[model samples]
Target chain A: MTEVTQPALTIDALGKKCPIPIIMLAEQINHVPLNAVVSVLADDPAAYTDVPAWCRLKSHRHVGSYELPGGGWAIHVRRNY
Target chain B: MAYFDAASTEPLHPQAREALLAAIDVGWADPARLYNQARRAHLLLEQARTEVAEALGARPDEISFTSSGTQAVHLGVLGTLHGRRRAGRHLVTSAVEHSSVLHAAGVHERDGGTAETVGVSLTGRVDLDAFAAAVAGHDTALACLQTANHEVGTLQPVTEAAEICRRHGVPLLVDAAQTAGRMPIPPGWSVLTASAHKWGGPAGVGVLAVRKGTRFRSFLPEDERERRRVPGFENVPGIVAAAAALRAMTAEAAQECSRLSALVDRIRETVPKIVPDVEVIGEPVDRAPHIVTFSCLYVDGEALLTELDKAGFAVSSGSSCTASTLRPSHVLEAMGVLTHGNVRVSLPRGASAAEVDRFLAVLPGLVRRIRQDAGVE
Candidate 1:
């Protein structure tokens, strides 16, 4: 079995609304090294769907999302180039 | 101001206004009464029904007027589920149906019934294979699909869907509020519903048509009016106006459709090229002629709409920031498209090329300004 790697960077966009989370992700995802994971913590409902859609559109790998203990989601994305 | 929100409600047609005034003078009496005035009123009501029915390719007896389109949908959906209870309590619908259909499904689910929502594609068209599979289940009582999507304007394959429902002995409830006057109601719908205001008729008028031999038992408390299908007194004047508007619109549809189609095509082709990072939503070819939707990547929908409004353009959006629920439009989410910075421009009849060009010219700058305000550029 392969060992799990922690996210290299985590974006705390908890209280922000839609498009903000997506914009933050877009601006910051390039900062991470290739194939490294970036986790975005967003409570806005649009992020749940738009983040994955954005990943698909931008050609990045969408790692699985995990629900935070507090009422939000930690959406993980792995950079592809 | 340029009105680009015809899908929300079209401005009243001149024919509808004239008919409404004439009807108010003579159709004020109760149609159910035995007086001479009532008899005259009944004739007008029946005449309107026949006109509407002809437009829908249905018989006069199949048409019933409801107070609003939402009511028609409720009755069409719940009544069918109730009538076919012996068959099953399951409902099948696409994910992009108007809130009326989805809310009716919600009510059914709350009342101990099961529902399955089939998803759509990136172009906002329903997956026919998935829809066929969803309704192929033995317990599905009814399936619902729109003639065309209200927001994105993608026309569903109603004929094919109807064939599938027929094979399964399931009824199909079609919400044709978007296409009733603009285009022919696609054939094979077991029951159909439409709102008058969408067709340049006055508000408070709705059409509910159920084909003969379709079993629809009303769930609401019993009333003798509307063949015991819809309860309450009829809006005779409104119904008359709605019928007149429908007939007039139908006559103009072929010409208006092509004109508006070319305008919409221009918007669809130009929006993406003129505005950077914009994705035009909905099917490119199989969509309704009058509506086009698009989304910008970094701008907020409400801000863009407000700026456009300031610039004398009235449009609608499906962005989370614009919605009261703070959620993106279910239709956009279902299609997996960008939901922020959304705009749905549904052209009204007789919309000019100059107006469309002006809109196209102003939109890119508005989007850019909104993006800059949001610190995107």
Candidate 2:
């Protein structure tokens, strides 16, 4: 996989389950500058399906998910609004 | 593995299974037909009706079978509302009624009728004062309440609410889907509904009982079956199985209730003590014997259920956020309790004490692991 630009903000959602990870991303999305990428690290299986769905529902951009070296996933979303 | 979702549906009782198999050959013919075979089928159907009616303390003439408990509730709510339309169009029900009753009330509203939803308390019991006030309105045509709350297992004040409705001349429809066959239904309800599957009977059989004097107009397209209340050919075999199961369960209810109540008490006492940040929902003293519900902070109910299932325990979660439905449980929300990460453990008939102990022993660690996986501090 190719390396992407470092996110403007990193959310440590690892071990966090759904809605929590989604809620964290939502609450902190605006903390970063608009259009900046925010990375959420989470392992909860629900996060895989829910994060992207949340992005679509909230009209944010789900950049994509990447793997963390230690395991789990790094879900990327861009603050659009 | 412990099968602890009886509130959802019980495994078929042995009596039900035997009755179902035996009746299949005898009940296959149309009961409406006049041949000798049909005569036997008709007899079977009548016998099943009598069994169910006797179990429910209602006349066989008043009980009609529907496809499922949800169907029975729809028929009960809509039939009563339509029957009393001339009196007024207002319907009264609880905020935590099963989706069936709520959906029928929604239809009533869409059809230009009005409905008042009474709220429940933190313990998930209906507020009698609010209910009485709601039913007291002269324009209220019907009031619906459940014998027990399905999600949290808290018994409702059905008899008291029924008295208020009676005083107001409003018919009270009781959804006894969770309590029927497990206990004697309290008296005074004008109409009652229950699902066969909830009590170890076969699926596809639901009972709707309308007291003889209650005003209830059939809303289905004109039909001769089930007094035109529920239209379509009767499910004779399933009905036979359901009635047989009802008889068996009712016969053993006193003993089963005691056994299950003790198990539930153990769980009620143990879960909070062993698992931190867990809130046990439901009225401890006034709840159903076979069911208990609790919610965990900082954990996902769906994930927890998955872990439990993997560990060989089949249970259910009340959290709406757990699955496809993103909306939280209206029952929990109505009670003003935490809706996140809710687990409802309902013991089936014959659930063993050892199984309950095994589940209790494994639950705390599983919940802790799930919380850790969620990264909740």
Candidate 3:
């Protein structure tokens, strides 16, 4: 169900709270093609656990998640190619 | 004492204090009795009902007293859902409702009723279209929304929301804990709940009003009391005090609300400007006039609250960690605003402009101290 908007993925989930990052990320991933990288920026602490669990369950790769400068965080996920 | 936590509980108005003391003996007897003391108690209770109903924009027959706002909300929500059980097991509500309503929703879910939390924009307004969608498809038994948030003071569009619920044949229950004595609710609210403490009345008194046509049922176990709605003996003196305080508060609400609104507007305009990296939360225009909130970047919320208290200014805050297992404020987080280090200040009724000035003077330094303590420049 990937939209494949671009092979180079862009998902801006910043300012989104828990379940939202997962929800937004899921929506964006559907648009991406196989093997695409999606960047997610979220501030919610729950997103830290939710995103990876979503990736693991969906068989997508959670490339990584890191703290964003100035109070938020960044997460990267790859679609299952 | 400088109590800025009016959101938590306002100082009892002078009239309410007088009423409570006077009623301790006079209204103490059971109205169910035949003695003169009982007759006096009956008169006082009836008068209190009239006064409270008028202040709350409700009818006497519709308003029933609860021991606290939390109870009112619980009874209102669970009771309504139970009454409508034949309709469906699904309910809809906003994300930023007070813990009372949210807690009721949890109970509803546990009881096998489905709960769908509608999203609120960062400014704390419900997403109308999304809200409609949540209630649209399902057998939505009821919808609950707060007239104004207790924590951030953001006002919700209850009137419009009522229309949406009406369209989908859903009853909207409004928790008016913050707005009851301030502004009148929209015409279409099916059931409404409020706390007297939030508006300068003593604790232990809450108001629940159900529209005449609403097919709601009480959730509490059977008793001849409350028409089988709320349980237990009524707090007669507390009800007297609630009625008196509501009357006194709203008598001057017109001028006072405007004055306080302007004062809070000043705080909204000045706080972020004076304190660097501080981001004020809530919609500037759509919020109640007595409260304002802001999150200071690199500042610790608990520390800011403590410093303010030490400086002779009492304020309130929901610690970031306490917001959820999730984050600070779902409303702030939903809005995508800064959520760290949030502080909510609610001005007391009858508070002076001088107090606001004193608070403004003390706050910047307190925030700076907090920042320093947090090891932020």
Candidate 4:
């Protein structure tokens, strides 16, 4: 069995719309140390694809996404630089 | 206001208006009846059918008028599937097809038929190799592809796709709603669908053409009208006007195509430079001549459209904020492009260079203001 490492930070953007979640992610991703993972909790449907696409465009790594028990998704991203 | 939403619905052409008025006076009588008025109406309907067929490169008997483009798509997709039920219950379509085709595919799936959507490239072009692979099996009954993307204006390889479908003995349905009047329909499609309003004709008029020998059985309740493909009393005047508009637009397509291409090229090249963090989406070249889309970073799509409306420029967007479903555009999502703060500018026929320049001059300031308001600057 593989061990799951916890995220260094979690952004609770559950009620926010698109581009807001993306903006919040972009503003806060740099606060963590290099190679640290950040999880963004978003309910917007656009966030599902935009988060992964944003990672590609910014040269960051989108580790994975997980569905939350309450709702929405936890999109995990690793800061590469 | 300078209208930049032509891809949604073009303003009716002068020729269409003239034909509509003239035909409305004489086309009110039922064409199926046996009377002088009926004879006149029948003649007008046949003449319109011939005109539309000539413009679309099909025989008159092959063309049928439907209520709307969406309806045409449903009939084309479901009808072909029903006709080829013995062959298989499998369907193939591109990932970025219009909602009409996608919805039809959804219906197919709900009815126990299976569908496979081939992925597209970053430029919004369908992956031909993947498309070929999807239709290789004998179980694949039909494939649907658009002549050009409505949102991004990227052209699909319909000729090549049609060839692949032929090799597999599956019929191909080409949705030419965006290209019917602007460009010549490429050969090799077994069935074709288009909307009238996209080409300067009135709304509520749609064109569906099924090539000879293509197996198609209407899924709707059978009626003897429109070659038994479409039911109910036809919108005769609308069909006449649509045909007139198609002919006029086709005659001027070459000149207008070049003129609009230059304007769109200017927009594609200028948007990224003028606006900070702007991504101009879609193919840089080999696209429809009139459409150019771009996404502005850290801006709300609705706010930007409202601001542009105040600035006397009408535009459309694929952003999630603008959509009623609150979902981002499937086209953009499939292409993995930016989906927020998006703007799609499609120029209509006779749009002058001065109007384009004025639009270009004012766009940067609006984007900057939206970004500032969002606290992104």
Candidate 5:
């Protein structure tokens, strides 16, 4: 598979937990251009599940999560509206 | 960390620690044995019983040690129910009784008995008239009411409720897990239950006080220990520690109560002023001095707790929508309060006014940030 690299807005939610990471995504997703990806970096364990669930509930595009070089995750979401 | 979850558990009191260490050496032998070492253990055990009963305003013979407060509630509720089974199998309790009593009622219903729950008011107080009506029925084998709510700290009208139960010829079991060591339980209660850890005693020791002639027999099969009220070998060291802690706490109760009450008042007054859309639950005047609970309308309890934890405050919540459980707090629900984003701050005996003020300083900005991130208006 081709290495898929996309330009994305980044949010540093590291050390923040669920509802927080999701809350950050909800607030900033609209600032990104339509169909552009927003990346949330978070360490709270609950964010792994809550971020994806939030995306599904809000009808946003879940661009998938990737492990950061350091500990924690980079969960990617795309603004659908 | 400012440990504001004392209702859950307090740090062991200093005297409890010393007594526990001393008792471990002397109380290791079985008090039920007939040897010389056993005689010493028996003496220590009897002394512990006397200490606990005196603190609780109970007789030494009436106080029996159980493994935990939940066990005491189980034995108190089920034993009384079984002892009065010939009269009726009906059990009555406030809807907000601890899960232990509620679970006991569940067991009663499972065994071909009936159970009824009385509701609470908006302030988390039991509706006394409704409680009286519930126990007024002819078949009410037992009625359970907490001295103060564990989550909200609302003091129930136990004395009045006890009188009603008396008129109805029903035994009243007061679950004083939240208040027993820190305050005196109102009189006229037939049976009482209290936990050790909540009042700075060691864990795994609970007191079950059955007033003489209350007509309670063990629900479980006969056993030699605790006069068959509680089965299994006694926790002699834990009992000694618990009794010592109770005595020490009672000695300082009046002073500590006023001090903690002032601290709680500070939090109560500050939280609403700092945070928007917050509802502070529980009766302001009639509640326990150590506990103050409030709810934020648009905040998530687990997230708030996480933020507070990061800010070095350990607290608890009654909101059902926390990360571990999706159900809202029954106490909050019964009281008709906002059930989401609830936080309960219960000051331990040594919690300082400075620490509480620091929490108050940090809470508002954090709530604002979370709400701003969530786009909550």
Candidate 6:
């Protein structure tokens, strides 16, 4: 269950392996705090576990993480700002 | 004939063979049984645990036996992830961990947890900056890094990675599947696992050790065996043999490792020079001394492996043994190297130089044959 009605940025981090995706999204999320919403796209299976957990530790709201048709995920995240 | 697949499974050592035969009558009884035979079984089990623990520089109470090295990793990874679930759901591991650890990460995700993957460089090393950043965002539960890759023999900097994991207060699980029987993990690595078969020991015996005060609890259903970390009836004879073999292998390590290291280094440096357009995998400096891998362009790896076998060489193909998939070696792919004609020659202890010379003598001809068949110049 995700908390909707927050600022969003669709960060498509699909198919990126390891620290590459994590670093990209972290840099992207730093630009604008409140309205920054990242929808991460990833093909790496580990990202399914890594992303939401990243949300939990950062105090940002993990809105909803749903899979796309081509095997990537659309994880909507909002900056804690 | 020269055999170079010891990384997969070394043949049984004479010490292990003797121990296996001796233990058949004495250690076959269930350790849990109250009878005399059972007491003997229990004593053997204790001795095995002590020897293996000492080899890994671990306390006796910290070690638990599992059915296989794969099982040990499965239990160790799952236990660490579950135990630290409260810290955060993100688990961090390298890209080139064994299939067992990869699958365990899958199980972790199936339970609604997430995993942060660290990428390896073309040299088969994890990027430290990336590693530092992966754990920065989350209360990472555990970070799993193999000591040396089983296929390419690349050693991860577990010490540096462990330092980062410690900074995030995450427990590090080191799969010393290749190096545990040969090298020590030393001050780094919180949890360690190894297979007996990799070190000329009997198959079906694995050691999983967790350091004291670590937050690792098994995900397996509660059981009376192995302090509830691993649950199953013991393979007593295999355990006894594994213990005997491990001791023997490590005892000879000072001399044998240097001998094999020289052999492997000669192969690593000379193979590419002698055989044209062959790319060797794994870090030249930071890898196991027993394994050397290379890809011959334009040749089918399986065909090359078969050709080597026909030439009285029992080396291994890095290509996945899954015939149905028919894919090239994943290890080579991750290292960003050619995957077409990958051959992983893992020298066993006591392998002679004459056999190595014979194999090398016959290698370039086989490579040309396969390359010609594949229509590649």
Q: Encode model 5's per-residue lDDT on B233-334: one tens digit a residue.
A: 999999999989999999999999989999988888888898876778888989998999997755888789999999999999975557365445667667
| Stretches of model 4 off by over 4 angstroms after superposition | A1-5
| Residue-pair clashes, model 6 | 14
DockQ of each: 0.70, 0.05, 0.09, 0.72, 0.04, 0.02
Which predicted model would earn the best TM-score?
A: 1
Q: Which model, 1 or 3, shows the larger TM-score?
A: 1
Model 3 agreement with the true structure over B1-377: per-residue lDDT tens digits:
67888888989999999999999979998866789998898889889988888887889888888889999999999999999999998988898888788889999999898988888775778898999888786688999988887778889988889998899889999899987787776678899999998888899999989888888788767866555678877788999999999988888888898898998999999987788866677888888879898766555566677677778888876546434345555565555554556788898887788988888888888777766654454
**How high is the CA lDDT of each candidate model?**
0.92, 0.88, 0.80, 0.93, 0.86, 0.79
Q: Which consecutive 10 residues in model 3 chain B have the weakest lDDT in total?
A: B319-328
* Candidate 1: tens digits of C-alpha lDDT, residues B278-372: 88889999988899999888778889999999988899999989988977899999998888878999999989999999998998888888777
Q: Model 6 chain B — which ten-residue stretch has the worst lDDT? A: B320-329
Model 2: per-residue Cα lDDT over A4-81, one tens digit each: 657999999887655597668766888999888999998765566456656654678888888888977998888898
Clashing pairs in 5: B320-B327, B320-B328
Candidate 5, position B176, lDDT: 95
Against the hidden reference, what TM-scores do the models get? 0.98, 0.84, 0.83, 0.97, 0.83, 0.81
Candidate 2 residues B62-124, lDDT tens each?
A: 999999999999999999889988999999899999999999999999999999899888888
Candidate 3 pairs with clashing backbones: A2-A30, A3-A30, A3-A31, A4-A31, B122-B335
A19: Cα error in model 6, Å: 31
**Model 4 per-residue lDDT tens digits across residues B162-204:** 9999888999999999999999999999999999999999999
Model 6's CAPRI class?
Answer: incorrect
Q: In candidate 4 chain B, where is summed lDDT lowest over 10 consecutive residues?
A: B368-377
Candidate number with greatest DockQ: 4
Candidate numbers sorted by DockQ from highest down: 4, 1, 3, 2, 5, 6
Off by over 4 Å in 3: A1-81, B321-327
